[model samples]
Target chain A: MQPESLEAPTNRPIYSPVIVNNKSAHHLFICEGYPSREFQIFYSSVDDSKKTLLLVSESDSTIDHDSILVTHSELTAKLTQLLGEMPLSTTIYVLGSEAFIWDVHSVATQAGMVAEQIKMFAPVSGQRRLFCTHCYHITEDVTHSPAVCSGCQRNLLVRDHFSRLHAAYVGVQIDAEDPDDLPLPQELI
Target chain B: MSTDQIKVRVAAVAQVAPMIREFTLTAVTGSLYPFSPGSHVVVEMPGEQKIYRNAYSLLSDSHDASAYRIAVRLQDNSRGGSVFMHQQVKEGDELLISPPANLFIPQWNAQKHILLAAGVGITPFMSYLPEMQRRQADFELHYLFRSKQTGAYQLELAEQLGQRFFSYDSDQAQRCNISELLADRPLGTHIYICGPEGLIKDVQSVAEQLGWPDSVIHFEEFAAPKPGKPFTVELKSTGKTVQVGESESLLEALEEAEVAVPNLCRGGVCGQCATPVAEGEIEHRDNYLSVDEKARQDCVMPCVSRAHSDRLVLDI
Candidate 1:
């Protein structure tokens, strides 16, 4: 079934889909995982009135297709053209390891986005799965479990292990009455 | 040119303190890269990292260029750079750094050499101690640290130079008196000092009273006074003008003016702040530039250095 608002899958096999909510003002948010090599393209009406935010793995393939670099130039250009048809403020966040995010900012700057406008972030631990082959789901709790896979588990060495925390939340809106004032989860271990 | 420049990959990283960490970077490009006693490097890391440009003094020995070392102390109350460096950077990570550059080096020929340091200001002095020791140069090192634990590079230094190194804990004991320390130092000695603003000022004045010429005294300052109010800056070449808000710096002002001025050490330590002066006077605030350089009216450090006059025009 098509998700009503947006698809936000957690710690499961089905990779986080390209979530979009156009009910209010045609806002779109894209989230991708590794090994999926996913390609998402959105077509909006000429009169749509909403902002969009794109969040992708820093290790994901670029939209340019010609260059193997992880830059979002092609994605950004496409979104820029799409935004021309709508009235909204769009933001793209390149997610990955700490170094990857830093590189994303550098590349994004070279691509000409105002340094202040670009939002770069990495996922907190447990909230996101760290897979070895981009296809396998290797939980951080595997040491306690007794299952093995033939996938790229050997290559599953952690990247940005220390930099990408499990409990930290990104793009979360905190309210005065909200119980979880802390963005990070209580028990990261 | 010296064949002593190389890019060293990180072999390991050790977190010595909550705010400080040491990196052991092994030279990958070449076998050996020679550096002077007191010098620093420009390090580059991967990604859209915010700590894109930073200068760290080389704490490693100048004799061994096979591997390079640096200690970074994280400043949480920072403008995003140092915090990122502390939290994000790790071991096994590859980084690019320039060959060592130094503003404080011991005069090996001097009959006596005096070294003074405060806090992490002990970095350049750390390298100098060994260099002077190797030369068998007569010198005394006065290490003024807030706390023994907070004093960076203490363990290694104390282990190496047992007697010549003097440790002063300001938190427990009274502040170190320059007059008292200098009065004992034999004449014909050259002094090299690096530390906070207050200590640098007091020592400079005391050294002057001791009849030490400016030529015999060398020091490095890492900070400057906070900008007070907004001021106007005019660019002579581009004919552009901008108001430097209190929240912003003169470098930010020139950047806003769309003027290109080469700069590093945005903090004003690295003479990278040197900017050409055209028609107006500037309030010199940096310690890197000499009096003659300031009098030439050719360049100014826009980062910490500011204009004393109401409206100043820059050559660039």
Candidate 2:
């Protein structure tokens, strides 16, 4: 087994379909795809007394009166504007795929939001984004270990260690120790 | 003296305010060690009866290490240290000082820094100005003092900070509305406060009541340990007993007995001198320990805490 230090980041987003924070003066929920059941529960769970804004990336038939629709290209610009106008008492919750949520998180952070001011829901899909350590190249939509690096074309062992800056998991060559003693590919949870 | 002590000579002394004396200290030998902004040094004053060590914020430019400047405000209830500095200390006197230790630092990640100071509490923030300006950090300074005669660096700071500077003189009936100042701030705004205990407590309570998180409200209180009844401590490891005097601290008693305890910022703020307790009740005075930790009674900060019972059995 790998050492505890090499385990997944402790701050990795865990999906909790409830509004846990009640103290914030304002809340902003950024929903990425069509509103899933989890998103619906998360959005509706917000206290009616608190000020809230809902921004949905995709146009859907279930759009509510409180939700605003924005294209993927305009999402960053729209978030920047909203964050600029929001007060320090604001808390942001992002619900989307792993990559999409992290993208929005980056935008919020750039707009001067602290880590405590933002929350992330778990990615909707199990697909991972791998960063090749040897070539510093990113391979998207990875599912299993022993995945081929798109840049270096080497078999990689995807480690659970995550980087918030890169928004990806570290992947090192699997056969670096012994090229012939390659382990069988196993799917990641 | 401790191994970390640095010998320095007092180069010059100036009465900056009615009760404040500014001392400029230069290294006795080589160049002084570099320290970050918001750092304080403990000056050891050799009195006839005992050595008085007091922590003072470095008011000099953080980038300059050749000379260190500190201001001392004479307390009405004279702690021997401040009295010694104000009365006995003069130019060309050699004094041993501890290296700089910082407990109050600006949050670099903050988009805007709001510094709140009352009277001599502006010392640490004075060092922060150059560094903050160098980094181009957005910040503002709000100073509250009794009068122009007692407000050290009032004119200098006003001239330096210009539009970002604000002063509230109580003598002139000007007051700082803590709630109004903290209200409606943008996200990622962090506030730092240093002043009297009342001001610190007021700002903290007001910030919390205004829905500001504890992490965003930072403060540094250089509170000297209040004198209490004499007590005794027994070291569990050595079975040695040390008598703690009323005016002195438990940490000083332990040090006198040659039982060294790691310490910094001896004003009871730093947690370095936290000692495990074997037996006896503790009178917690330090701000370092939380309410739950104090209630646990398993540990004591020797720097300020005293024994509630006649004797304390320490796990030293």
Candidate 2 per-residue lDDT over residues B229-316, each given as its tens digit: 9999999999999999998889877877888898888877879889999999999988889999999998999888999999999997
Best by DockQ: 2
TM-score of chain B of 1: 0.80
The deviation in Å at residue A85 for candidate 1 is 87
Cα lDDT tens digits for candidate 2, A25-90: 778888876777767777778776564545555455445676667877888888888777777777
**DockQ of all candidates, in order?**
0.00, 0.51
CA RMSD of each candidate after superposition: 26.1, 3.1
Lowest-scoring 10 consecutive residues by lDDT in candidate 1 chain B?
B44-53
TM-score of each: 0.53, 0.90
lDDT of 1 by residue, A1-189 (tens): 333335543221112433332222333333333422322333232123343434454575544332223234455454444434432123333444333344444443333333333444333223323444344444433221112222433323333232223211122112225544434323332
Model 1 has an lDDT value of 0.57
